[model samples]
Target chain A: MTRHMSESDSDRSPDAAGRSWHDMGGLPAGGINPAEHDFALWEKRVDALQVLCATKGLYTVDGLRRALEEMGPQAFESMTYYERWISAVTKNLLETGVFTTEELNARMEAVAARGATYGDASIEGASPEGET
Target chain B: MTSLPHVDPPAFPPPYPSAAPRFAPGDAVRVATGHAPGHIRTPWYLRGRVGRVERICGDFANPEELAFHRSGLPPRALYRVRFTMKEIWGERAERGEDTLDAEIFEHWLEAAEG
Candidate 1:
């Protein structure tokens, strides 16, 4: 199959896409297709951040920014995907009214100190009762 | 207090014809639309779940701008519905600990008898 670069290809190049995946030393791109690997990684990162937000109650914009930064380079370049994932999680957090911005920030700082590092965490905790 | 001149209340505007109420606070529903190319607030877990609506938040409001996208109109009336975590994870939810909230589009729901 001939690889044809589209008009927008210049803006969305593989190099741009690879910035995140490259942190893991270029996952089997030749054999397994790096873009697919990056997407999978991106999906997993989203799941991890969702748990962090729900359990730790880190649902503010600043809190999300901190979580993304903690995600390191691999999850950073896939920022667009990260934003979408957080938006979904934030909507739920707001609807449930579990934690406020101040509480979330404090939780983030505490989680950061625990050396939680990068990985998915379970959102197993008390469910927030509906308010408003 | 001095009495003011009586003024007729501003003419009430005609009420919009309400859309047919499909799902209620405890009805199962599923998303009819697939993942589009642009920004969307719906999550992957509630794509095909038979969950219950917890609250009906009216009208679309852009969630991205509220978070980070900083663009797009406010999302339409969003519904905060509850789904058994078991419905989403199938056995993942422990006994008596099974529920999740999904911010779903109004068009994405249909009544399902429990």
Candidate 2:
């Protein structure tokens, strides 16, 4: 995709070289994609995980934001909102040694292989209190 | 609040009484230019930019400190700083009418030297 930057855009901010990923103030925002404010199923799951983890005292909102901000420029630019959230949450979990990279990869592989049966048996027990 | 021994306190309170806010509404100020690690709410675009304090939104726990799980002691006064898009984006601003309002904490601001 072509960036809508002007010829003098770079000269405007001499210090842009050191600016962080979250600094997108004057950059080419292209048109706002006017999609309705709708969350995909997986996006909803990501949001639920964030809220649940925070409620359980695992991490603070600020902590999660900091993790997202620390993401590499490419990943930060490429990810969707919920994708960034999940990536940051997972990074936090891994950094704190709550789980290892290997374990996460293995679980992903297992879920992919098992597909429909991955969490079927545990769904009843895993249902949050009072939800059923 | 009951919490696991390893878990940090979730609530952040001022570690000490904050000093009186230095500036008031309509006061001219400039965002300080500095970079530190961890969670910083100050947007880089506003750094070193001059703006007027629209209003004092009162004090709250310093989010920068809270990002590291520390008590945001002596909550910094939060201000709604108003700036024209031209001020932030210089000649690159698309429209002269476009404006931006950012919530900036006192620690990130200083009396406008200009």
Enumerate the candidates' DockQ scores in order: 0.03, 0.21
Writing each residue's lDDT as its tens digit, candidate 2 over B12-88 gives 43344435878766677888877665677887767767777776777888888766656688788887777766666
Kindly report the fnat of each predicted structure, to 2 decimals: 0.02, 0.38
lDDT per residue for candidate 1 within B8-52, as digits (tens), equals: 222432133224445445455655434432233454334545666
Clashes (N, CA, C under 3 Å) per candidate: 13, 1
| Candidate 1 lDDT | 0.49
Query: By summed lDDT, which 10 consecutive residues of candidate 2 chain B come out lowest?
Result: B1-10
Off by over 4 Å in 1: A1-132, B1-22, B62-75
Cα deviation of B41, candidate 2, in Å = 2.1
Say which candidate scores most in DockQ: 2
